[model samples]
Target: MRALHPLDFLFLSLEKRQQPMHVGGLFLFQIPKDAAKTFIQDLVADIRLSKSIPVPPFNNKLNGLFWDNDPEFDLEHHFRHIALPHPGRIRELLTYISQEHSSLLDRAKPLWTCHLIEGIEGNRFAMYFKIHHSMIDGVAGMRLLEKSFSQDPQHQGITAPWCVANKRTKRLTDPEAPISKFKKFTNTLQSQLKATPTVLAELGCALKDKKNHHPDYVSSFQAPSSILNQRVSASRRFAAQSFELARLRSIAQHFNVTINDVVLAICSGALREYLLSQNALPKKPMIAMVPTSVRQDDSDVSNRITMILANLGTHLADPLARLSTIRRSVINAKQRFQRMSSDQILSYSACVYSPAGFNIVSGLMPKRQAFNLVISNLPGPKESLYWNGARLDAIYPASIVLDGQALNITMTSYAGKLEVGLTACRNAVPKMQNLLGHLEDEIVCFEQLMTTCNQDSINTMQHTQPS
Candidate 1:
């Protein structure tokens, strides 16, 4: 039996009746008129073939003090099909999926679940998949998609990604097998002996660099307690909103910031407004927990996860200055990460950002609190992707909001659009929908500023032009 990694074990240990720790997404697809069944069948076949998929090395749990191994792999136990009631609308479908995602995954099985949802309105289909945060992170999940799908639409008859029959070999009882067993034992010993130095070096370097490492602005410690900070119930509520990528790009270009910067700025502004409306704004700037991938190599599917405690300059009234401050904070945080080893960065992040409350309740800690809230931005495919013939309409990622931090905001950029999914405890974020409106308003406000700046420049050029 493989053991769970310390980080993965942490996720498992933190899960309680009220808090089910898993991250997932709700993807909407428009079924092709001619071949919906064929496409879905092919997709299912692919999933079937991809059974017994290996968890990433970093995500695997330590079996003991000495070794780490993959979690048990189970396919039928993880993937399921659910038929929505007839005349199902988006609201009904989302409500169902949200409730499903809120509960804990069965620990007896592998740490992931995929629900193939059908019978939704208007030739559309939805797929809801959730994996324990310990099993696969946001970046790793996207990489899995890349492996399962093709860039070409005509790609067909590909074997399922994980269907491995007869994964286990029959044991032989011959006396000669003892020699082979001894050799295997020797090889394992040799491998561990080689790995020990590297592991020790990483541990020493991580401890030395602990103070200097940070993940992102939002992942920091200064985040104050808001309505979103509370005890969460097992029940989850999900809400999603989509914005055109071009519009955000235009705003970012005008301000000379990145698309991610603009997205975060808009979220900051919206949160600021929302808190003010409730008369519950924090006196100091609130912090956000942001996860950034440290995987720099193309061949690696899993990346190291680190967080930066971003100061979401929500206290700043001027949108432009707030955005600029956020930008600087992010840039500095990223620069600090660039200087450290990936192992050091991940270790530092786990120490600083792991939930203290859960650790205490689980009897693993005495007392402490980590950072508040999680805001993640995951890059997705730029070109339109099809599953079978069904065109993927939108992808919304629903992340886990832990007990103390009842709100999780995750965004995925797909096919030139940003789809933001907000998952929160129903009681903690009663005004969740209002946040959506506030986000839209902030985006428009930025767009208007850009328009005014452009107009001013054009008029100035006209006045200075020679006849």
Candidate 2:
């Protein structure tokens, strides 16, 4: 059995009926033209009878404080094929996802499942792959997911995520020798010791900056309570939409910011409008815990992510003003992270979040808010990808929401488009789907504002020029 990391164990320990600690993606694909009706059936058969054993993480089941390989790993239990109800629309498919995502993964088996769903209005089928948070973080998951497909449209054979060879050796499943265990212990000890100074320095700086009330200093726990911070129920509502990557890139170029900065600004505007509609907008700016992957190796084993807090600037009414505030907060956080090694960043994040994790797991302060929510942007396949000759359409990430944090916004860039996914407690966030419209509205607002700014600049230059 492999020992579980403290961060991995937190995911398992925090699992509850209301909050199932898992993350997944919704992948849509267009079936090959003039394909027979048995396309989906054939694909399912091929996957089920592929005779491939599940790889690491997929085959790893939860043991006491370690992960043990399930000798009786069942492929059928982890893979399912379903057809949408009559009239087969995206809404029905999303409803199925929202329902399935609410339930907890069975601990007795490998903590993962892949559902091959068909019956959409178009000639499209979707695969929903979900795995427990303990097994993998978003970055590793995205890499593994991308590996399941081929970039060539004519590539044959179905490569299920479980069938993708991760190149892990047998030692991963075998018992560790005593000397190996000792070496691992010593290595872990040394890493933690080395990271101590960095953690302490960061804490000192954070304290000094907080005392001075620095504009860019965002406290880990400095989020205001609002409707989004309310206790969430088990029921979830998922909504996803895609926007042209070029649209956001144009805005970033005009504003001298990054695509991620533009994304956060768009989310900020949408969230601001959402709060106002509910008449529950907080007076102070809301905070978002943006997760950053620190994985240094290609071997996908366990979670390797650290988070930085960003001020959403939801309190600001002006879109440009909100964008500026968010950009400053994000830039400061990035600079701080740049100064730390991966181990140091992980250690620092662990230290800062340990108390809040305890409170969440113990339910001591049910109403306590730790940042408003999570906004994760994961990189996806840049070029168009295909699976068994089907063209991949979009990849939407569905993430977790805890008791006080009822909403999560996760997006990924794929095929020249930015696919945005929103997961929220159905009850806590009334009409959560409305955020999609709001997101579109924010995109248009940015484009118009940039155009106006450019035109004004051109007019000013023309007037200043001598006749």
Candidate 3:
């Protein structure tokens, strides 16, 4: 048995009915053209009959402070084959996911589930797989997903996540002569101690800048108590939409920003419009806790991410201006992380977020908030992927919405498209589906900006040239 990291244990300790601390993906796939009617049934049966024993995370269950394989693990309970009701439209599919996402995972079993769903409107099916945050984070989760699927369209049979070998076992140079537990603990402590001074110095600068209210310096305490920071119920609402990667890239090029910066701006514009429509737009801008991965390799699956607070600049009416502010804030935060080692980055993040964490777990300061919501952008397979010969269509990520943080927006890039998923507290965020339309409108606005800028540049160049 291996001991749980402090971060992992925190996730397990903080979970409740109001906040089901799990992250999931909704993968839509197209059935092969020549497939028989029993395709779905046969696929499920094949997965059930696989001789491979579940490994690591899928087979790991909580045992006090350590993770141990369940001796009597029930594969049937963790894997379910379900069918959508008649007419099985996308709405019904999303509704089912939202309902299931709201429920808490059973602690007695491994904290994960894979649901094979069929009977959709088109000749497509979806796989909804969710695992507790304690087991894996978004980046680690994506790595597992890539290994389970295939790049070749003709790849045969299905390989569930657990079937993938425990890659961490090979990370150690000599598994047979593993270092002693005392040595490992001491080494970790020494590195953390070395990081303490640097991390604390940065924290000092942050506090000083917060007092000045510097626009570029994002202070967590600056977030306003908007509807998004309200207490949440057990119910959840999920929506997803896809956008072409090329268009977003074009906009990022014209604006001199990263793709993630563009994503933040798009979300900022959509949220602005959504709040305006509901007459709940906060006077001050909203702050987003953007999660960044610090994992150097695929060996570690547990959480190795740090949260960076970003000023969304929702107060600005122009999309370009908003994008500029978003870019500056994000770049500034990233520059800080770049200066620090991974361990230092994690320590600094812990220092910066400890109060908020305490508030979340204890509910001592329910009104105070560090950030309004979470906006995470996770990378996905660039090439088309497949499973059991079925063409993988899109991958939408459904993340967690905490009690105080009522919404989460997560996006993944796959096959030249950006698949976005929005998870929200159903009661706190009304008409959340409308945000999808708002996001498209924002994209069009940026496209027009790109066209006008390009035209002006062309006219200037032509005039400057001698005839």
Off by over 4 Å in 3: 169-184, 453-467
Across residues 14-76, which tens digit of lDDT does each residue of candidate 3 receive?
898898999999999999999999989989988898898787778889998778778999899
Q: After superposition on all CA atoms, what RMSD does each candidate show versus the true structure?
A: 7.7, 4.3, 4.3
Clashing pairs in 2: none
Between 1 and 3, whose lDDT is larger? 3
For candidate 2, the lDDT comes to 0.86
Candidate 1 off by > 4 Å: 1-5, 36-74, 158-220, 298-303, 350-370, 453-467
Q: What is the C-alpha local distance difference test score of candidate 1?
A: 0.68
Per-model TM-score versus the true fold? 0.77, 0.94, 0.94
lDDT scores of the candidates, listed in order: 0.68, 0.86, 0.86
How high a TM-score does candidate 3 get? Answer: 0.94
